[model samples]
Target: MIEEGIVAFSGWMTNFELLSSGWRAGLIVFGLVFGTATVAFMVSRVIAAMERKFIETRNIWDDAILHAIRLPLVFFIWLQGVYWAAEVAYYYSEADVFTANDALLEIGFIWVVSWAVLGLIKQIEQVLVSPVKMKKPMDYTTVNAISKLSRMVVIITVILIALQTLGYSISGVLAFGGVGGIAIGFAAKDLLANFFGGFIIHLDRPFKVGDWIRSPDRNIEGTVEQIGWRMCTIRTFDKRPLYVPNATFTTIAVENPSRMSHRRISETIGVRYEDIDRVSGIVSDIRSMLQNHDEIEARQTLIVNFLAFNHSTLDIMVYTFTKTSEWVKYHEVKQDVLLKISDIIIGHGAELAFPTQTLHVADSVKLKHLEHDFGRDQGRGDTANEAGERSLRDNHEEAVSQQKSVEKHYAKPR
Candidate 1:
């Protein structure tokens, strides 16, 4: 029907002898351009109505399909219209540039179709991952990985097809790529490593976005914000952004605290040595308290024992886990447990230990005697003090002898 209309229009244009070929071509070009705009507008309006209608339906595929094709369809229409107008111009002007019209049309069609397919893939990925759109939303990481792989495949296929359309052999391209791949791999070894690291992460599923992960091998303690092909972004405790290469994860061991079942609260409390008799009772009371506490995980390793006797204090170990794993809530639970332990100790009439020291000395007479001897040594003064090593040694020996004699005088028969 459209061909017949065009033929009738051409016949009608030929009947106008007054109009030159250039003028007729110009009119046709104007008509084509105006028609393309009108067609694009109509298609957009039709797609908008279809989108509104499909959005209400339960199936999401229709919406995705309509959305993906809307812009690309308009573009395809414009391309065809312009192609036809250029053909007419070429026929009249015999231009050399328009000779590649067929290749350009094929390439443009491939590009448009690839664009639509990519758009559809992206839309489907979004719909699957959106909690509001899907009843059971898919994992964002998995969906993203699949979407990326699919898009890459689509892109590679499109490129190959475009090359074939431009008179390039697919087999030759593949052979050259296979041979050049080795050199490319060597040149971009790190880049390839990071890429493969990301791929492994996607497959292994060690940690995902929003997981609190820390690496003992590296100073990487943060919540995962974004995981990309080359690097991962982490938000640290201090709210700083850290960009780490994906390859780094391949070598390091990551601890995902977010996946821990419980947070440990291991502490050693000590009491004064005087509370030796009360140590057992305190330990028992602490264990009972932990067992009855709402926040403590009694089913796990609950250990409250008198660990050891220190110099000034008796050590009591409190090793247990909290029922909660949230960081802030875990601290609160730990604080409550510690305060309860303190109360239990106080109730048991035991005091927490502190560092202390005691000094022992001889009787007052011995002290005075020592003081007198020290004064006598001072009285020997600068002459003995300034004496050479031999003289000082002789004086020290003399003092020792005199002190022994005095001690003998004060000694009793017993």
Candidate 2:
């Protein structure tokens, strides 16, 4: 009986010890999680303050950086906290899974840092290349190439480092990758060519996003939307998106109409031939109007003169350039100037001409010449009819003479 009591007492002590350890571990986990939460709150507050300060700066890139880092920084802080907790558990707990948990937490931390780095690189690009007035805007093709290259470098480096840290042999992976690369190269020939073409476009910089481009090779005209590896996206004026292969830009001659300094307004105004006396006055007045107009470009070529005499009207050509290159403003200015020109023509009692053909007969010599020609034609017609009638009568007399000769010859000899 005394031995059974001793065994039962030992069992109770063992259970008590297990319960105590469980409570301690629970306390530690709770304490670490709570501490992490507190630190995260403090860090987020600091970042919010920094963001506000950055936004007040004149340079917009700084603000953009702050925004980019905000979420990543917070995420990193929490990831670090999880790593520390796992590290704590690994040290205290004698369990096999704890080691794995710690390793995973470390890897997670590395990945978060890598992700943050990528975000920073992308955000920095905006600061480095986006301010058109402060810095030269990067070419669309080149910018995309740089961004993609940067991302690849970061990811590959991180993966290699992670693999090395995890005690994996990289040589076999590299060998396998090399063989796979050859196969992929053959299979994706067009894709690779398009990627190479993207590189050329980046270097050449024929067009960029939002710039209007038209290809003389075919009927492709639109504003650039995005330049990518395999294809470029263009948004047309008709509110549709066009996808073009990047390789096409390398082969075709592209015209960047968006880069033009000014828009042209060349027009031909025709006036009635009766307004000949007012043609010179109208040309000079129109030239003055173009010069004095604020929208008309003064430095460019402005030609307003009586250009040609059409069959029905006098053509006065007005060729000039508008100061603005915008499509809407150019048309508005052109419409206003044309209306003013119309008003000027009307005030001078001149009318716009249309398609017409007029026969003008001169009273002096040309009229007499036309009458004499008509009489000659009529006399020729009368002579032709008289000759035709005389020929018919001769044919009748010849037939009758032949008939009488035949009758005399065929008659019985008397």
Candidate 3:
């Protein structure tokens, strides 16, 4: 019974000694877990308080940082706390029976994964929100493209980090990537051409939205409405949308009428042959009149010429240009110029000629016709001849009689 009691007591003493020896290590593990949890809770509370303050103040940017950016930041903060706890665990383990280098490697893998994931989240939030704050009107395509580009960069960076962590040398990987990129460049030559074309458009600014453009090669005339990476979108005057490849626009001649300060208008005015002699004087008057015309550059008005002599009349063409492109304003200016021209024509004594021809009858035919008339009634013809001569005398007598009657009617005044 005494030996059995000694054995039990020895066993209890051994167990107690072991428990006491491990108490500090156990306390460190407990503290690490407790500290990590405490820090995580405190971080979340602080973030919540910040969001509430931002909302109350009505600060949009601050609100974005709180609501939009806080989640990733919270994750990183927790990761940091975990990282510190992990370091404490490593220190405690170093003093124990086991080295935690293997555990540290495991933790490191987790850390990298956490960093990549959280970083991705932060980047995506920034990409989406950055354009929201911009004052310029947002283009969805541009925003999406920029977002995709940034994501791709982030993905590539994460891939490289993962590869490095897995013990791959970056120098060798870079060399392989260089060779691969060269092959890709050769394969996507046309895509590269379009990409360069897009860059050229941004730099050159050939045309902007709402501009009327004419492409020489395609015989396309339209208003520019959108410019994209692969194509330019144009809305035709007929209201059809045309998507033209950037390559074509970059290589072709583009006529942008919107770039001009004013448009030139040219036309001709005609007059008759009877007005030809007076044409030189008319031309000088027109030149003087055009000098005062608001729209006309008299230097460019080619001529007021006697263009041709046609079958009936002479053609005088008036060639001139207007200073404005607007169709309505141009017509108004032209109408005023024409009114002055018509007034100038009427001021001259020579009238505008119509198509006319002079008919000549032979004297022999006239004499024959009169002789026949005389023979048809000889006695009557003699009397008609005396009557024809007496008709002039009768007109003179009638005029004298009318004059005497007019004088008698006015005699009362005398």
Q: Candidate 3 — worst ten consecutive residues by lDDT sum?
A: 1-10
Off by over 4 Å in 3: 1-176, 298-303, 310-313, 317-321, 326-328, 335-414
lDDT per residue for candidate 1 within 162-248, as digits (tens), equals 999999999999999999999999999999999999999999989998899999999999999988999999999999999999999
Tally clashing residue pairs in candidate 1: 0
Give residue 109's error in model 3 in angstroms. 17
lDDT of each: 0.87, 0.78, 0.64
Model 2: per-residue lDDT, tens digit, 327-378? 9888999999999999999889998876553334345554455455556556
Q: How many backbone clashes does candidate 3 have?
A: 0
Q: Give stretches of model 2 more than 4 Å off.
A: 1-20, 57-70, 84-96, 128-145, 357-414
Candidate 3 local lDDT, 213-331, one digit each (tens)? 99767778988887777777999989999988777877789999877655454434445666777877766777677777878866664466666776555555667777776658878
